[model samples]
Target: MANSIFIPLHAVPSGLNEIIDLIAFGFSDVGRSVPNVYSAKSSDADENWKDNFVFVEDVGSGERCWVSFFETTPDVTGNKEWTWLAGVTARWSWDFAGVVAYALCSYADSIVYNDSGVLTGQEEYSAKDLKGILSRD
Candidate 1:
């Protein structure tokens, strides 16, 4: 079985198409669905939309995770609020090279690794030594 984890991004940049494509390649099972990603909606009370969340899945192992982006905002009392706006649902297995490659190539800084394992697309990072740089941080 593949391990899963959540990767939270401060915000999803405009250049997300390429990353999505890469994630599709990395995971065998890729599906596009309308997800209730926004947290400000009234329907979020019971978490009914939780299942509606879209994600990528690893067909081989059924390991999956979701990516959510929320804009920071101030509430009525000036308190911080993580207003979820949009996100992607992804499911994957041990072979996450393609996912890693897509993520690194698209937005290396926004990446948040939840699990430690052999990542796909090691070749692309070889020259740039992304792994080395990432590890240092």
Candidate 2:
């Protein structure tokens, strides 16, 4: 899986709202009601992937920003179940890989935000900074 970039809904074309809503609903149960809020996509040839735009309001400035997410999967274990080794291990490994990869990418973005809220002037990310983002140490 690749890094999931955060995108604002406003940046999306007028035709893709339904796909965003669908992804949002998949992420949270509350989003289910928003299904069909918009019309169909721009064209039948558009590949609507599991990508979505998020409008995040700045806690201090109240400015809204957008981000996009990709390649997300549902976790049904509820955090307390033991592993079932009876099934194919390859599938389990792939699932875990997606989870870990997403987590690492998110951590990097968080560090980017914390170190430079808007990342206004940073031209390069140092190796040290990269590790710091990975572990937040």
In terms of TM-score, the best-performing candidate is 1
lDDT of 2 by residue, 25-135 (tens): 322331112212222234534544234333323233333323333432224211222111001011122222222222222323321212222222342333244333333
Deviation of model 2 at 58, angstroms: 2.6
Off by over 4 Å in 2: 1-49, 70-120, 126-137
**For this target, which candidate reaches the highest lDDT against the unseen true structure?**
1
lDDT of 2 at 36: 21
Query: What is the C-alpha lDDT profile of model 1 across 1-137, one tens digit per residue?
Result: 43433233334434334435545433322222211212232442343333343344445545555554445443511223322233333445323333443343334233333344334433223313433433321
lDDT of 2 at 54: 32
What lDDT does candidate 2 reach at residue 25?
36
TM-score of 2: 0.23
Deviation (Å) of 109 in candidate 2: 8.8
Instruction: Score every model by TM-score.
Output: 0.33, 0.23
Whole-model lDDT per candidate? 0.36, 0.27
